[model samples]
Target: MRLFLKFIVVGFLNTVISYILFIAFLSILNYQASYTLSYCLSIGISYLLNTKIVFNVNRSIKSFLRFPLVYLVQYIFGFIILYLLNQYTKIENHIGILIVIFLSIPLTFILSRVVLLKKIQ
Candidate 1:
């Protein structure tokens, strides 16, 4: 129960950070980087928070290498999805952002459970 709560809190923080960065880059900066900037920034923050806060992952050689690898793959998939949605949808940017947020729930949970939270063998 505690772990689940921790995950939710961390996940919520990550979502806010990612969404803010996405909007700022896409709307304000007018940087048509196509989500790359947001993905890089948010993924880094999410990995850091998830490792230290949510998982209490101790810094170790194996874990360090593996954790980032898992995050990279997950972020790639997430970026692709977000990009495709932005391209294909008629939804407003704000609504599209919200849609992406909901869409991320299962992917986030699965990746966090199966990869990030999995016991390192």
Candidate 2:
């Protein structure tokens, strides 16, 4: 329970930072790079925070390599879901994104715990 709460807090901070960066880029540059750049940057930060602070994961080279792989999978999954929601639904983009983000939390927790933070067998 406590760990889950920590995950929410850390994830919220990380998401806010990345979302701000995404908006800034969109507002200033008006480029078609909002989804990719923001997702990557946020996920990277999230992975680091999750492992080191949220989970107190034991650091290792293998863990470092695998963590990014897990994130890449999650990133791709998140992007596809968000894009589809934005295109197919009447909901606002941010709201749709939030829906998708919230839905993925359980899946992400499973992946992070089983893959990144799991004690090596």
Candidate 3:
């Protein structure tokens, strides 16, 4: 429960950063493009916070390399949800992203925990 709470806090911080970047990029790009760019940029911050704060793990080149895979998977899942919501529902891009973010939190935390905490035998 405590770990989950920490993950939520880190996720909230990452979401805020990504949303700001998305809004900035939306000025010149479409929603999909903005989301992609913002998400990619925020992965670094996510990795840092998740490692140092949330998981309390030491940074390693191996873990850093594996980290973005978690985000990539999350991004794909979120993008599909975003697309579906925007295409078939009344939600707009801005609002749809918030829904997607909240929906993705659990999956993100689980994947991140596996990648960050697994010990190589």
Candidate 4:
């Protein structure tokens, strides 16, 4: 429960920061470009918070690389589910995206825990 709470806190912060960056980048660039840039920026923030606060792990090169891989999984998972949701239903794109983001949380938490905490002392 405590670790979950930490995850939520860090996750919420990451989401808000990333959203701001996304909107800012969107105003100056195309959607794909904006998202890619913001996603890359947010990866650093998320990895630091998850390591130092959420999972209490030391910063490591291996963990740093693994962190983005976890998000890549989340991104792919979100993309597939969002695509299916949009195809089979009348859900709007923004709504579908939000749903996909929420749906990806548990998986994100599990995978991140595995990546960050599984080898701890």
Candidate 3 Cα errors over 4 Å, as ranges: 119-121
Q: Rank the candidates by lDDT, best first.
A: 3, 4, 2, 1
Question: What ranges in model 2 sit over 4 Å off?
Answer: 28-32, 119-121
Candidate 2: RMSD over Cα atoms? Answer: 2.7
TM-score computed on alpha carbons, candidate 3: 0.96
lDDT score at residue 115, model 4, on the 0-100 scale: 87
Off by over 4 Å in 1: 28-34
Which candidate's lDDT is highest?
A: 3
In angstroms, the error of model 4 at 13 is: 0.3
Predictions: Cα RMSD each: 3.1, 2.7, 2.0, 2.7
TM-score of each: 0.73, 0.81, 0.96, 0.80
lDDT scores of the candidates, listed in order: 0.67, 0.73, 0.93, 0.81
- Pairwise TM-score winner, candidates 1 and 4: 4
Clashes of 4: 0
After the best TM-score superposition of candidate 4, give how far the Cα of residue 106 lies from its true spot, in angstroms: 0.6
Instruction: Tell me how candidate 2 scores on lDDT.
Output: 0.73
Put the candidates in TM-score order, highest first. 3, 2, 4, 1
Query: Per-residue lDDT for 13 in model 1?
Result: 89
Candidate 1 local lDDT, 31-67, one digit each (tens):
3363567766776687778778877766566665566
